[model samples]
Target: MKLYHYPLSGHAHRARLFMSLLGIPHELVEVDLKSGAHKTPEFLALNSFGQVPVLDDNGTMISDSNAILVYLATKLGRTDWLPTDAKGAAGVQRWLSVAAGDVAFGPAAARLVTVFGAKFNPEDVIGRAHVLLKRLEAHLADRDWVVGTGPTIADVALYSYLSSAPEGNVDLSAYPRVNALLRRIEALPGFVPFAKTAVGLAAAA
Candidate 1:
């Protein structure tokens, strides 16, 4: 397996992190987004959207971070990481939607402004981030993982951006339960970290 990714992209980190947690052996092919590598003809052929984190498993191309996660779990038959039953599957799917929707527009968008100089209203995205965080804090108040008893792809989907939300100036100090959930994910075996930028370091300090 080969993962085409960029270090700073939370979306890319989702695929990379899951592969690590599952102990899958793969190659990391860094796409130089700064130099327009992702938009190149060769790259666009893999994904018309021209995004990082495209997975090539023996020439089978899979794009989108969440899709990659689903493909991996289904292909590997890892029902532990992704439930097979209807209710369990739906539960995980719900959070995956949140990761793509609310989490994307909220915490993930906020970080884009600081980390990549993306043009977005900081106040708006930061507010959205907190809104999502508060909901997550309440949801996690009585549970460690997002979907089920054990950690699933849902947890992995939300981990990258939420853990780095401070970079977006979305302070997480008030959300103890969410912080605890982050800590729990960090302690898991074979866990790989999302690389922090200068903005994130200052926010942490």
Candidate 2:
């Protein structure tokens, strides 16, 4: 298996991290986002959006972090990572949606403004992050994992951005439950970390 990704991309990190957690053997191909390598024809062919974390297993290819996660979990026959029951599956999907929506527009967007110099309003994006964080903090209060007693893809989906939210100027200190969730994920065997980028509001402050 091969994973084409940028080290600093949370989307890519989620895919890579899950693969590691599953103990799947894969190679990491770092896409040179700074050099615009992802915009090339070869790269776009793999992902029309030209995003990082495109996975190639044999001749099969998949794009999008959450999509890749589902593929690997299903392929590995690990229902624990992705439950098969209708309600359980729905639970995992809910957080995947949150990862793409709330997490994306919140902490991820805030980081984009500082790290990538994107044009998002810092106050708006950061505020969005806090809103989502408070909700997650409450939701995770009595739960060790996102959807069940054990770890699942839902936990993996929310791990990266929430752990790195501070880098986007969204503090995690107020969210003890969320922080505990992060600590539990980190303690999981075979866990891999998302690479840290030094550019963000936390650095400036």
Candidate 3:
């Protein structure tokens, strides 16, 4: 398996992190976003949206981070990471929606502004991040994992941006339960970390 990704992209990081957690042997192909590599015809052939985190498993190509997570879990028969039953599948899909929707517009967008000089309003995105964080804190009150008694694709989908929210100026200090969940994910065997950047340094970038 090969993962094409940009290091600073949270979407890409989630896919990379999950492969690592699964103990899957893979190659990392770093896409140079700064150089317009993703915009080229060759790269866009893999993903029409020209996004990072495209998985090339043998000849099969999968795009979108959450979709990659689903594909890997299902194909590998890691039912522990992705249950096949309707109720359990729906439970995980709910949070994967949050990862694509709320998490994207919230912490991920906020981080883009700081780290990549994107034009989103810092105040607005940061506020949105907090709103999502508060809900996650509540949802995680008595649970270490998001959708089940053990870690699943839902947990993997939410990990990258939530753990890196501080770089977007979204404070984690008030969300102990959320922070605890992050800690538990980090402690798992084969855990891989998202790259970290200082807020000041990211802003200057």
State the TM-score for model 1. 0.98
Model 2, residue pairs in steric clash? none
Summarize candidate 3's per-residue lDDT along 46-119 as a digit string, tens digits.
99999998999998999999999999999999999999889999999999999999999999998888788999
Candidate 3: RMSD to truth: 2.0
TM-score of each: 0.98, 0.96, 0.96
Q: For every candidate structure, what is the RMSD over all alpha carbons to the true structure, in angstroms? A: 1.0, 1.3, 2.0
TM-score of candidate 3 relative to the true fold: 0.96
lDDT for each residue of candidate 1 in 49-161, tens digit (9 for 90 to 100): 99989999999999999999999999999998899999999999999999999999999999999988999999999999999999999998878899879999999999999
Candidate 2 C-alpha lDDT tens digits along 89-173 = 9999999999999999999888888778889999999999999999988887787888978999989988888888878778778
For model 3 the local lDDT of residue 196 reads 89
The model with the greatest lDDT is 1
Give lDDT for model 3: 0.92
Best by TM-score: 1
* lDDT: worst 10-residue window of model 2: 196-205
